[model samples]
Target: MHRNLWSGFCLSSLLAVFSTLSGCIDSRGIIPQALRFDDAKLTTDQTIRKADRTVEWPRDQWWQAYGDPQLNAWVELALAGSPDLAMAAARLRQALALAGVAESEHAPQVKLDASVQRKHWPADRYFYGPGVLGDTTGWNNTTALGMNYDLDLWGRLRSDTERALSLAEVAATEERAAALELQNNVVAAYIQLALHHARLDIAEAELKQREQLLELARERLAIGIGTQLEISEAEAPLPEAHRQIDLIEEEIALTRNQLAALAGKGPGEGARLERPKLSLHGEPALPSNLPLELLGRRPDVVARRWQVAAEARGIEVAKADFYPNVNLVAFLGASSTTGDMLNFLTNGSKLTYGIGPTLSLPVFDGGRRRGKLSEATAAYDLAVEQYNQTLVAALKGVSDQLIRLHSLHEQEIFVGHGLETAERRYQLAEEAYRRGLTDYRSVLEAQSQLFDQQFLEQQIHAAHLTAQADLWVELGGGALTDDSGPAAEQLDAHKTTLHLPGRH
Candidate 1:
């Protein structure tokens, strides 16, 4: 009796010590350091200008600014059916479901367990050595209802739920990013298709002109008025023009195939695509002053931010592992001696019930808890660094695109003037050659220079449009301007849909 009293005293002292340690650990909340960045402090080029800040940002459907119904249709198709976007959407749903699972931990869980079985026990069983509870070889039946719930004394469950919610938000943003990517790809492809059409037209016109010049040269040579050298020079550009036609046609066909694939359709669908008539000038006008914080609205940046938040919450969860876990458990059960299991549910049968709390504290674990805490802290730090890098890259992307657009605008002006000058020079050279004031070589050289100038002009025009498309995409396809919660909401609304263009 004295030993039993001493053992009880020792156990009480141990419990008291552990309870004190748990309180101390709980007082030190696991909160990661906060991160912040200034909106106007990022590095920007001198070409950046200030515009009316009051002007509204671009709409989410910014491609509509191009006024091309076909482009709008294609973008809608890609957004709804692109495999990449669908994958991101699926990931987001999975994250949300995981979050729901985490949330369920906050509530009590109850389970009903029922079993019926025949049992054979020796009359000399250890607990009842002489069959004290009646015959030991009869059928045994039991039924129980059990309930268990974590007490969450240290806010661990709350932290876990928050971490899951943050991850779900990250997935939501990624889905938006994927949708934006699909929109950008479709627009760029459509622009390339248009450029191919222009190239083909230019090649055909140049080839026709070359054929006329070749005929004129052959006629002059036959009449002994032109040298064989002149005929050979005229023949030189004709084959190149023909080759350009073939090459451009091949590119157009390939581009259409790419668009069809992007829209999640068969290659034959590409053959039905018409030449795009997109006007690129002054469409989707840019805001005057772009604050650095605006880039934070980008889906990728937002996703990275959520990643940091989730990792920060993870640290709290890991730190909670160092403290005691408390649980409330209860069970109500009945046993039946006969083969009829339903007898256990009757009031007359032997009944048993238990209700109590369980507490567990880690005294030793080979430093596993400390290691987990360290890992969580390190992961949080990594997430912060990654978020910083993503922000920097986003700023650079915006600056680079701004510089490119400005340079293209300047180039277009000069190329336009050069094209006009070359056209006039070619006209003068042709008239001079017809009157025999200049050699046929002069006319051929002038005409070749004119063709080169025209091609350059066409190329410049195409590049300007493509640059605009690039800028549109770099700006997140105007996703930042929308107040929608996430692209996941859009995906959910279209869960049962194959074509979602009309739905939006």
Candidate 2:
């Protein structure tokens, strides 16, 4: 009867312990309200023209749309070598490692401990004063294996791990954003360098023409057909032309150095690089309708969305802290005070072991737990606000690019006509002066007017190219694919399972 009773007690104790560990408080009911935004309000723009509707989706290799091999090569180099990209990748790795740490917390943790020490105990120092232990001196050795498992009875560990997982996703999106930014910057710098190159060519050509006119003026004056004032006026353009050339050269040098840095190389690295002749086939095509789904393709938006999810998980973690914490701990060990230290390893040595579950309940925390929960909720609110702000900014960015492109295209037509008229007038003035039908001043005025128009055309062309680049960047640097559909929609499928307040 006693044997049966002992067996029943052991079985009952095991069942009780297992039952305690298996129970988890339901905290999902208290999850904050869903996050919402009007899709039409975010994507609807009054500035999109009908022409923009005749567009297609952006390509993954959008830079290739410019049709410049050198430009494509440079961008690839930057992507491969840029230090900014390297750092972003490192951050992603770190976040993933931290996520691993959070996961490890949910698993059983085991530790081994061992110690050996030589000690002399004098019983005389205690109640006996002279030789209580009988000069007890020996080597004490101990070894133990301990195991612990925290019973997540409130989903605290799960919530913590979810937060970490979301953070890792955030890091990955941030890296993508960094890469997009780097590519855009490199393209812009290359465009500027090409503009300066065109400027230099124009300046040199103008200087040669101006020098020819100066010679003619000097010849006319010597023959008493031209005044010294006409000669001086013609001479003035030569120095201006030289100055323009000097400035353009300096700008080209600076731009090359900038590109080199973007490529993660020394300044001198740009010296051997050739000038880029990047030209666009046409303005990049755009999707007829931009939905909120497409807008989420922007890395910044995705990262922020992930951040909001992570913060929401943080709220769950804080709430879990208000509940009781239970942990199962077990230890097995042997200790021996014999002169032979290895005796601890023998089964004959004294043994000590313990195994049990521990429970802790908060009684008087002075509102610390409540304060933390409040803080987490506030953080979630901040993340949601930031996400909204980013969405608005992204929409505005696309609209701004569209407006600028439209204005530049309209101006291009007018600038082209102006350039042609100025060229004709300069030709007429030069011919008249050669035949002694007009003064040198008329020729100088015509030359200056023509130079201004030519420079204006180059500036406008560069602006057009840059506007195209900005548009591509706003469209997520062509990172989206048809398979992915829209980034927001893709995130939605996963977001549905998350405890965040946001709704697609």
Candidate 3:
């Protein structure tokens, strides 16, 4: 009874020493220095505030709003085949697999181990005991089944798993962002093709007009009422008009090739593309939820937010390292160098089995744990700042698109009026020249003015279309919804708020 009491006291004293040693490695001075930015708390810029906010959030297939079936088909094709998206999908899968690895830490691990080898015992008089078969060779064999499980007393495994899952979420959102960007590229390139077609029409018409004026000048000269200079003036513009047609056709071909490449097809496929029929009926208005919903709407922003959450979990994982780890371990095995190899398995005396709990306390690591915690905290701060920057840039992108669209709309109206006036002025000038009331110079001036106005109109129209597509991209292209949360719930569940070293 006295010996039993002594053994128990010694065990208690040993545990006390372990606990005191563990307390020496402090984690009090390390903490994350960055705070996450709240989307709702961020003030909306005047640019977003002043814009018309009547439209709903964009639909998932926002490109279809342009009423172009071909565009929709191309976007779908790109989503299916683009290398960029495929890579993003692969990265997401990899992250999910890593998350699985982390989660497996919570479950018991079982392993089977077996070994067999031929051995020889040398007869050394000083090292060998008196026994039979002292110099004999024999088969040595062993087999064991072992299991281990971590207790996770400090939530380390949970935080690690959560961090991995958050990174997986980040990959998913980045994949979505890549898809949206692909869609935008397809639409923008298609719009350029349409603009080239419009320009071609203008060029062909101008060519025809120049030919007609050249013929009319000849007739006037034949009747002794027009000078040779008039004929030369009309002929001069014909080659330029033809050149313009050639340039626009080249642009159309190049844009078609670009669209085909975006869809992961060859230049020959682009050669078969028809002229794009893209139209936007009205201005794309801002959603009622502006900067607030913008957080979830933009895939890039969502990805950054997920990254921040993952980093927050990383800090937790690092903090957990400062504590002790406990693991339950069990093993059952047999080993023998005598009799048959199977004797160890069958003989009860050769069998061995044991189960116990193992403890690991970090008594000293020369500030390694503190350094890791510091690194994790710094990474967390970087992620938060990146998220903040993404949010700001996203809002700025929306405002910039809105401003361009508004300006393009106003420019389109003025260009349209100018085109009409130039048309009337050219018609009057032509009539005056035919009636011998003015020289060819006045008619040439009016025609040049009309061509300039027409070109400006087409340019403004293309700008308006491109701006609309950009706005759709900025608004998240229907990836966002009203119910999208800030992804704080999961992080909050495992959050261990700690004070910074210098702060309260």
Which of the numbered candidates is closest to the native, going by highest TM-score?
3
RMSD of each: 7.8, 9.0, 10.3
Off by over 4 Å in 1: 1-15, 20-36, 50-56, 123-128, 132-136, 222-224, 227-229, 281-293, 338-342, 482-504
Residue 368, candidate 2: C-alpha displacement in angstroms: 1.8
Q: Which stretches of candidate 2 lie above 4 Å from their native place?
A: 1-36, 40-43, 49-52, 124-135, 222-224, 285-289, 482-504
lDDT of 2: 0.80
Model 2 lowest lDDT segment of ten? 495-504
lDDT of 2 by residue, 281-393 (tens): 54444444454645767899899899999999999899888777899999999898765878888876788999999877665566677677777887898888888888888
TM-score of each: 0.85, 0.86, 0.91
Off by over 4 Å in 3: 1-8, 282-284, 287-290, 340-349, 481-504
Identify the superior model by lDDT, candidate 1 or candidate 2: 2
Model 1: weakest 10-residue lDDT segment is 492-501
Each model's lDDT comes to: 0.74, 0.80, 0.80
Per-residue error for 52 in candidate 2, Å, reads: 5.0
Count of clashes, each model: 1, 3, 0
